[model samples]
Target: MEYIYASLLLHAAKKDINEDALKNVLSAAGIEVDEVRLKAVAAALKEVNIDEVLKSAATAPVAVAAVPA
Candidate 1:
């Protein structure tokens, strides 16, 4: 979702993921910010460790299916 991506952008930029900051980022991207979603995102990520989640996601294995030759 755009909201999640916006938060990721903020995390990558080393910026705080607060409602105001998220709103600014979304506005810059020309996406309308939803007040409810913004509040939910800020609350959801309040105690998350972005770095840890990224590391786990990066190292997580993907299932690839082989096609018949």
Candidate 2:
């Protein structure tokens, strides 16, 4: 969970998302860093465009319920 949050934090700050950076963020937050998770997150984010994903998520429609009269 922290690994994912760290990735998002790095993306939000326009910082390079890498294992060392993610570890730094986790360490700064006083959380123990897990190497495997950190590497996994870095690899997962390698081809992702965080900003574009956020934009599409924001524009996605939500279902609304109609109230009965």
Candidate 3:
């Protein structure tokens, strides 16, 4: 998947999303995208199902909160 698409998917997942962070991640991945394009990509992502993307991203390891005594 394109970096922007992946970023948008991550954003849709509501995982503390940020455009600049997405842009940086994409840049690190060797994908160069302009802000205008990024906005368009974000807009396009709004049509996608957020839950599915979140479920997919959830496959990765994450830290869960511990219950307090």
- Which prediction has the highest TM-score against the true structure? 1
Error of 2 at 48 (Å): 1.1
Off by over 4 Å in 1: 65-69
What are the per-residue Cα lDDT tens digits for candidate 3 across 1-69?
575566665665665345666677678778876787777666666576666966878986766869798
Q: What is the TM-score of each candidate against the true structure?
A: 0.86, 0.82, 0.46
Clashing pairs in 1: none
Q: Candidate 2 clashing pairs?
A: none
For every model shown, the clashing-pair count is 0, 0, 0
lDDT of 2 by residue, 1-69 (tens): 778788999998999999999989999999988788888889989988888998998888855668789
Worst 10 residues of 1 by lDDT: 59-68
lDDT of 2 at 56: 90
- Local error of candidate 2 at residue 7 (angstroms): 1.2
- The regions of model 2 sitting more than 4 angstroms off are 64-69
lDDT of 1 by residue, 1-69 (tens): 898899999998999999999999999999988899999999999888888998998888966768779
